[model samples]
Target chain A: MTRRKEKTELVPKEKQPISSQAGEPTRPGVFYSPAVDIFQTEEDLVIVADMPGVAPGDLNVDLEDSVLTVTGKVDEPDSDWKLRYREYGIGGYTRRFTLSDKIDQSGIEAKLVNGVLTVRLPKADALKPRKVLVKAA
Target chain B: MTVLRTHRFNDIWQEMNRWQQHMGDLFGERDYSKNACGVFPPINTYDNGESYIVLAEIPGISLDDLDITATATQLTLKGERSPNNDIADRSYHRAERDHGSFNRTIDLGQPIDPDKIDARFENGVLEIVLPRAAHALPRQITVKN
Candidate 1:
C-alpha cells in the first residue's frame, strides 16, 4: 500500500498542478498508516507492513516504554511526469505497536525488502515454554 | 500554455467502463473502482507529453511471480503472492495479510506504441511506460498566411 498524500502541497508546484487529474493535491508532506499483518508464535511475535516506494535506508524503528514505532519516508520520484490519475496516494508511512512485557526488546530484528517491512520480537526467557522434571513414583 | 485534460470521474469513457468491470470482479465497491483496491495491487497513472506511465505497488511479492502484458491501448497484470514465513515456529497467532493471485487490466485511454513500451519493476513498484502512438499525439496546426 502507498502512503496517502494530504490534499495540500508539500512540494512547490513550479507550474505542475495544471496537468493533475487525480482530483487530490499530492505534494504530500503527509504521513500515512501502512497496512500491516501481525502474528505471533510461541517464541516470537512478527509484524509485516506494506510500504511501497520506500527505500530501506529511509526507515526508522525505535522502541520506548515498550511501544514500538516504524516510520518510512517515501521519496517522490524525480521526473517531469504529471499525475493523470491514481488509485493510491503517495507519501511516507508511520505506525506504532505496543510490545507486551513478555517481549525481549533488545532482541528485536527488522528487515525491509521489495517495499515490505518485517519485524521480529523474541519472547522473554520467562515466557518461553520450559520442560519440568517429575519424580518417578 | 496548453491546458491539459483534467477530467475526473464525471464522464463515462469506454476505457473506464472496461477497467471498472475488471475492478468490480475483485472489488464490488461500485464507483470506488475509480479508487482503491482490496486484494489487488493499487496502481497510479502518470503522463508526459509523449507517453503514459502506469505504476503499481506489490510489496512482499517476488518479481519472478509477476507477469505483465500490454497492447496498443491497454495493459494487463497478473501475479501471485505467497509471503515468506521465515521463522522456525509455523504457528500463527494472528494473520491479516491476504495472499493469492490477482489479475488486472487497465485501458490507457489512448493508443500507444505497444512495441516501444518500457517496463521496470524495482523495490516492489512496477513502472510501465507506454509511448503514445504517432496519430494520437497533438498535431500543431500551421497557419497558411
Candidate 2:
C-alpha cells in the first residue's frame, strides 16, 4: 500500500482597500504620503511629520471641531534627463486627526521648520499631572 | 525698496523655467530627485503665558522673498526659493536643492491673538510668536479635603 499525503488548509484573509487604477489592493511602500510620528508626554502630545521638498509657504494646517488636518503640495524640481534612481519625489500630503477631550483644543500649536511639521497639544487643566498630598491622621 | 528686489528675482526665476521644460528628467538617480532625502531643519516650539514661539530653518532663502501671516487660529508662511546663481555652469553629478515656491501653515489651537503675534526673518530662518488670548490660558483651581 502507498502512503498518501494530506492537503494543507488555507486561511481566508480580510479584503483590503484597492487602488483606483488597479484591481489589486495598494501596498504600503510604492507611494508617498508623508510619515508621522507622535510622542505623548505627561503635559502634552507632540506630533512630527516628514514632508521633505515642501517649503514652509506651501503647507496648510487646520484644526476644526477637534479634528486636525494638514494639507500641502510640493512641485517637481526642474530637471530634464533620464531618471536612474529616486528615493523621494514631490507629491501632495494630507492627514487628519480627531482629538480627545483631555486635550486643550484651543491651546494646540503647530510649526514647520526645514521640512518637518511639529504639532504640540497640551493637556486640559483637569488632565494635567498633579501631585496628591496625603493627610496625616 | 525690499519688495522691488524680490520682484525682480521672481521675474528672473520665472524666465529660467520658461527657458526649459521638465528639467528633472536630466538627472538619472532618483535620490537626487526633487524630493530626495535631506536633513530638515529643526523646529523649536516654546510657550509662555502670552504667546507660543516658533522658529523654522529655511536656509538659502532670502528674507525679501518670504511672507508671514496669522489668522485667529492659523499662521501661514509663503515664499519662493531661488537657485544659487554663482554655480552657473557647474554640472551636478548629484543635485538635491529644491527650487520653486513653497508654503507652510501652522495652527495654534487657540484663537489668533493678532495684536500680540510677532514675526521676523533672519539668516533664512523664520521666527513667529503667537500670543494666547487671556481667556485661552489654563486656570488654577483650589481643592479642599
Best by DockQ: 1
Instruction: Candidate 1: list runs displaced more than 4 Å.
Output: A1-28, A130-137, B1-34, B37-39, B85-88
Superposed by TM-score, candidate 1 places the C-alpha of residue B105 at a distance from the truth, in angstroms, of 0.6
**Per-candidate local distance difference test:** 0.75, 0.57
Report i-RMS for every model.
11.1, 23.4
> Which CAPRI quality tier does the interface of model 1 achieve?
acceptable
- Residue A71, candidate 1: how far off, in angstroms? 0.6
Off by over 4 Å in 2: A1-31, A79-85, A131-137, B1-145
Please give the DockQ score of every candidate, comma-separated. Answer: 0.28, 0.03
Most accurate candidate by TM-score: 1
Please estimate how well model 1 matches the true structure, expressed as its whole-model Cα lDDT.
0.75
Lowest summed lDDT window (length 10), candidate 1 chain A: A9-18
